[model samples]
Target: MNILFIEDDRMNRRVVRDMLDVAGATMTEAESAEEGLQLIDTQDFDMILVDLRMPGMDGITAIGHIRAREDEKAKLPIIVVTADAAVDLRDRCIEAGADDVIFKPVAMDALFDAMGRLLARDSDGMLY
Candidate 1:
């Protein structure tokens, strides 16, 4: 599957990229929300992984833009990755249409499992 990853931290980006690569998925990386949005406009990806705490146009905003698109692109799966493990934060992301949320200091197994679940969800259109 082709995945777009939006992350600002260099180390975190690298870790996620490596994990995705090792998982055998092709990935495209974006260091900021603007870049991520631009990529969304220009390419096709099976899924998107976004970081919540970014300098500008955070993950929530990014998801909004994606969902605002026409029907075809709007159906893409979006997962929010954040260090904030607060209950309310996860709730907010879910309410805003995020498919899933992952905690920071990312665990390889956790990420893989979450990615698999998100990507392999049934055709019934359930986000998670």
Candidate 2:
């Protein structure tokens, strides 16, 4: 599957990249929300993995913008990968249009499970 991963931290990005690579999934990395948005405008992805915190245009705002787009790709599954596991933070992400949230450091199995579930729901037309 093609996935877009937006993260500001190089180390975290590398870790996720390696994991995805080993899973045989293709991924495109974005260093910031702006870059991620630009990529969204031009490419097609099965899902999006976004970091909650960034220097500018945080993931929540990015999710809002993404959901606001008129294209069908705007409805693509969005999973927040964040270090913050607080209840309010999770609520905010869901309210912002994220399909699911996974905390860091991300476990490979959980990441794959979340991706699989979201992709399955999306194919079954059960995702909103």
Candidate 3:
């Protein structure tokens, strides 16, 4: 699977990349939301994993930008990965067009579980 990972923190970026690699995702990472958006415009991904906080555009805004695009690209499954675990934060992410949300420091099991659900739903054409 292809994953677009947007994160600015170097250590967190390395950790998440390693975990996703171990999980069999071919990852394309960007240090900020602007870079990530540029990548999304030029390439395709099975899933988009974004950090809520960043130096430039935030994840919520980034997801909105992606969703505002055309066709299948606009409908891409976007998963917000963040340390902000508050229910209100999650609701805001979902409201901003994130297909799902995962909290950071990302638990491998939970992250993979969320990915499984999203991929399954995408493939089956049914909500997971």
Which candidate comes out best when scored by lDDT?
Answer: 2
The Cα error of candidate 2 at residue 124, in Å, is 6.8
Task: RMSD for all candidates, in order, please.
Answer: 1.8, 1.9, 1.7
Clashing pairs in 1: none
lDDT of 2 at 91: 85
lDDT scores in order: 0.87, 0.93, 0.87
**Model 2 segments beyond 4 Å from truth?**
122-128
Candidate 2: tens digits of C-alpha lDDT, residues 1-128 = 89999999999999999999998999899999999999999999989999989998999999999999998988899999999868698889989999999999999998999998887774555855
The TM-scores of all predictions, comma-separated, are 0.92, 0.94, 0.92
User: What digit string (tens of lDDT, one per residue) describes model 1 on residues 1-128?
Assistant: 89999999999988888988887989899999999999988999999999988998988988888888886778788889899877699889988879888898899998888887876777776655
TM-score of 3: 0.92
Runs in model 1 deviating more than 4 A are: 126-128
Per-residue error for 124 in candidate 1, Å, reads 2.5
Clash-forming residue pairs, model 2: none
Judged by TM-score, which candidate is best? 2
